[model samples]
Target: MRPAHVIAAAGAVIASLSLLSACGKDDAAGGKSGAIAVTATDSSCEVGAKSGAAGATTFKVTNKGSQVNELEILAPDGKIVSERENIGPGTGAEITVSLSAGTYKVLCSAGMTGRGPSQTFTVTGKGKATDPRLDAAVASYRIYIGEQVDDTLAKTKKFAASVKKGDMAGAKAEFAPSRFGWEAIEPVAESFGDIDPKVDTREADLEKNQKWTGWHQIEKALWKTGSLKGEGPYADDLVNEIGILKQRVGTASITATSMANGAKELLDEVATGKITGEEDTFSHTDLSDFKANVDGAQKAFELLKPVVQERDAALTSDLTDEFAKVQKLLTKYEKGDGYVSYDTVGKSQRKELSDEVNALAEPLSKLAGVVAK
Candidate 1:
């Protein structure tokens, strides 16, 4: 199964959705700093600096492989520290982070599947970063997530009603919009532990007897099997599950670390899944997922922009421009409220989408560290 650019809660890659810019070096404190270059080929991961004095360090990653590559910084326990995704062949992205001395892993997913490569990256510093103003920003973003969750639940009800009523055309129309809220706030959703799996887990992640449920399950019935005879009960379960999530997310404890990383993770979802046409295999609504991920990430970025601007105006400007570029590209795919199905796109055009999305991911990957600082 495809892994993350659009997904990261614990390991590998899972994402929901890019940009490029010349970001300036650290202006805060430059104690021991250097660029650890990460290069990815079709079959392997290449890392330049494996060890560093770690108050703050930079990883300059370039993808030399054919597929879109996402470079991840992982804690020894496997939680993602930071990542940059949608990095297409011949393109690059970078991130600078302040860290406590510890062992870490540099991960790259080349084929967007089975672990592409991993290497030890040891940080040898005891220094710490001063906490930025994250409380209010994170709170605001949580509120945003809650709002999106509510919308997801509401729209899902509409979708389920259509499905239960056997209005396949109407139900199909509602499917993409119903997922927007969940995709935007998935990392947060995944934070709920079991609830996420229950609501969105696909056959790929479950054991044969795990009793798969949620949107993807319903997705398969509609698109893959083209059968709705026994789908009404499943549709009802989805609505109920989202309703449960809506209640829980309202009071969830969301942190800047998660929200910032959540933005990157959502993009990872798009890079690894939607872009590859491996997600939504039935309806081909991958473009719809792609847009939601971007929208979700953009909201997070917008909320945190004030803090980032104060830190570095140039980097913020570059990110702003990159978002616009990606948005313009998405506009080309827009048809009414949704986009044309992923299968409708041609090979050359798919490459174009890949490039633009990758361009967005490069700059998009830096969000976590900038705001977390």
Candidate 2:
């Protein structure tokens, strides 16, 4: 999903700290000294330097545009390696990514329309050696992603079968459950840059004249119309696209920093879409997506907990407490199998949930800094 401008205030502090810390580093090794400056404007994305050493490199992004812009680093194959989204006009944000030796592209999407100016960025030298604990975090997260893809594909197939048979009740019963796996590993799925829009685009995100084909299309049919009529082709497309997502999983490049950033991004997903009940509009299944996002974010945090504990014990404690609080709050709304419809949730209740998410999001935003250290 294309998210709204939702950078938490707490993240700005960390971005400054990261910039300060990088200033003291030795850049003697080819663009490794300090945070690289990336200036994003209405029509251009300009990099301060053309190359950097292969390691955890921070881009100090300043939005010089009049609209909200996003900074993205794309790999040679065009997969998004890391991105900082929803950067408002005249505001700045930072994204730290661990890069390997390769040629990459740095893009700034003006207004978050997925189009903007780009500059070629090259990483030189073998990447700096990383801590074993960080390496372990990446390995464990990769395993988790693979498992999620496997389970999501399986559930999606069952949902598709029900749709193919024109069994509206069964498909509705399976819809939210089928989406849990996808929501859990969404960051990984979204990195592909191609498959995510095909499978997960919401009605609001559709461009002019673009065909609507995805889970939401089927969902609208199931809940709003109470029929699966003429929906079989879209169902088949979903399954096939999900199958492609499974195949593309192995090709994704991730790092310990990427995992941390992705965790924060998951919370952003919750704040912008799931919390607003915009994700599953027709089905009112936003809480399921919300819980899955939290699940995925917490899993990433848990995998990196040892490293985080070793680096900043207080941050770890804060994260743990906040995650528990949010989970406990979510539990109150649970029905027998799934959550109560989001539309039934009162404004005050929604505010409570939003508050918990914002609280959790604060400490979680610092995760990339901790892991990168």
Candidate 3:
């Protein structure tokens, strides 16, 4: 099935479960005298509402199609009043929401679209007091984090194994996918506010050596056909560099695993409604956890740093500076809105950051053999 379809199916289930567990008071002054019925058809959603006293009403949704789907009720303010997920094709479920007298939209989009068709309803009377489903929504996020982390670990291991076999092409293919997995789960990591400061410091280095910004200027010399004299050694140097990076694969795996486990616990708290997304936003608190993990990683790097320095202080300095830049970028997010606006930050900055980080890796990767000689 398409990814959208799978997401829709999963959402339907969560929504259905939450609806079943919901309980509310029925005040005669602000209760719907009848039920509201909604239907989803080929890219369209239809909602039926009966004239009533108004206030709080319950919507019982029945999926009359063969595809799984979900329902979302949006308030004027864009807050979700009630959302039902994982409704099996042909199964029926109900969602109760407290709404005041006004217009509201009922949206139905299968998990795949990330959005669905919407139908409006009118409630004429005083609005009823209702609560948001913050708890249930966070529970869903917990599940998402676990799945992403598992995928990341598997991909990273495969990438390392490919490097071990000297299959640079294979390793490259695995890189982006693995990187994406970690990036998606980063928000969960940020919740801890425990990331290492050293990692934060690497930002400047990454900025200076980015592939496009600075490296692009030297790409011709770096990868020319017959290894040009001075640069030839650099290419040959890299041929054996993967082996050195492969040695650290075990460390990377451990770090990824540890972060996944910690993220799960944090997500659990979110699922139980004990914490709000705002509470963990930008992972200010979780930075502490990340810092501890970075500390261990720093220890591992320390062993290699000496060898790296001996082989090429320029490379070591490049990497150290790159890490510092990353630290600074992360620290910026630590304050204010806790959002890392990669777009607003500009591509130039991003390119610079990537160059520096890659440059650091370039030299360190050659250090093993360099030190041995």
Candidate 4:
């Protein structure tokens, strides 16, 4: 979170993450052992070894930089394999990732600047096959994804019935909590390709001539225009597409790395959408979505915490403390079971919230790397 002019929500986020991880041979991706040590300073990234086998390589990173720095593993396609963000000077962190046989870049930046030096590491051997334990964990996560879809579908159906009955007040009341189920599983929801945008597209994200037909579209009609007439079809289409997602996610495979990165990404979602007040602009229910996104991300981290603690107890403790701080800060905005409207949050308050979220996110960014098989 950087200081901006603090304008009103742009009312849109650029949402095309069309391209979007591993621990073991039996771990998350495939398994091998050997740490690729890295030293970072203001000027350079030094990787200890230039080449190794393709699975379970740990990057033991020491930030000798003049200030805090970040280290990232970029895949050949440029997607982040994993990363460690905001590491303070004289501090060190380890990121273990399962790698396939290929060339990859180990990049680092001092003071969080864009410009940085990088070292190339080559994986010379094949990845090991998946371990049964990793297989079961992935299976369990898929089951959890399925459960959320079921819950979301149930909530959205009730929401749909309210819309179809032309009960604007009832539909408005259901808006925040109903969206919770969807937000809680957004990491997985986002994977169904077109379904996520279709289900939640804000009017700002609509194509030049494309019609809007999701929650935000209906939100505009309900809260801005104060009408739900002719909105039933949007409701129907939303739930039907969710059903499609449910069926698809049931057979989908999830990995430990995905869950960890998804957790980090979810918090990023809050930092971008909620802290900035760019979501639910008309209904001002951004706070509810904000909470739901944190819930989803935290759930994923909680699942991987056991493994993280096994690797680094100190980092786990830091994460625990930061998460509690963020949760406590968010609780202040609650008025019983609901939150105050987003419009009521002033710029300074938003800055405070943004700072707490960034605090949480900095420690959280290390999670995916630590848990890599």
User: Against the unseen true structure, what C-alpha lDDT does each candidate score?
Assistant: 0.71, 0.83, 0.40, 0.71
Runs with alpha carbons beyond 4 Å of true place in candidate 2: 3-33
**Candidate 1, residues 1-373: lDDT per residue as tens digits?**
2343333331222221334332234311221334677777777877776688756567777777777676766666555555555565666666665556788888887755435688888888675554456657777887788789989999999999988887878888999999998888776676455576677766666654778888888888788777778888888899888888877776554455556666767776776677777678778998988888888888888888888898768768877887788788889988998899889999888777777766676666666667645
Instruction: Write the residue-wise lDDT of candidate 2 on 216-335 in tens digits.
Output: 999999988888889999999999999998888988989898999889888877876777777899999999999999999999999999989999999999999999999999999899
Q: Report clashes for each candidate as comma-separated counts.
A: 25, 1, 64, 9
Instruction: Give me candidate 2's TM-score against the actual structure.
Output: 0.91
lDDT of 1 at 144: 86
Range of the 10 consecutive residues with the lowest summed lDDT in candidate 3: 271-280
Q: C-alpha displacement of 246 in model 2, angstroms?
A: 1.0
Report per-prediction Cα RMSD to one decimal: 7.1, 4.4, 23.3, 9.1
Which candidate gets the maximum lDDT versus the true structure? 2
TM-score per candidate, chains pooled: 0.69, 0.91, 0.31, 0.70
Error in Å for residue 311 of model 3: 74
Global Cα lDDT for candidate 2: 0.83
Candidate number that wins on TM-score, 3 or 4: 4
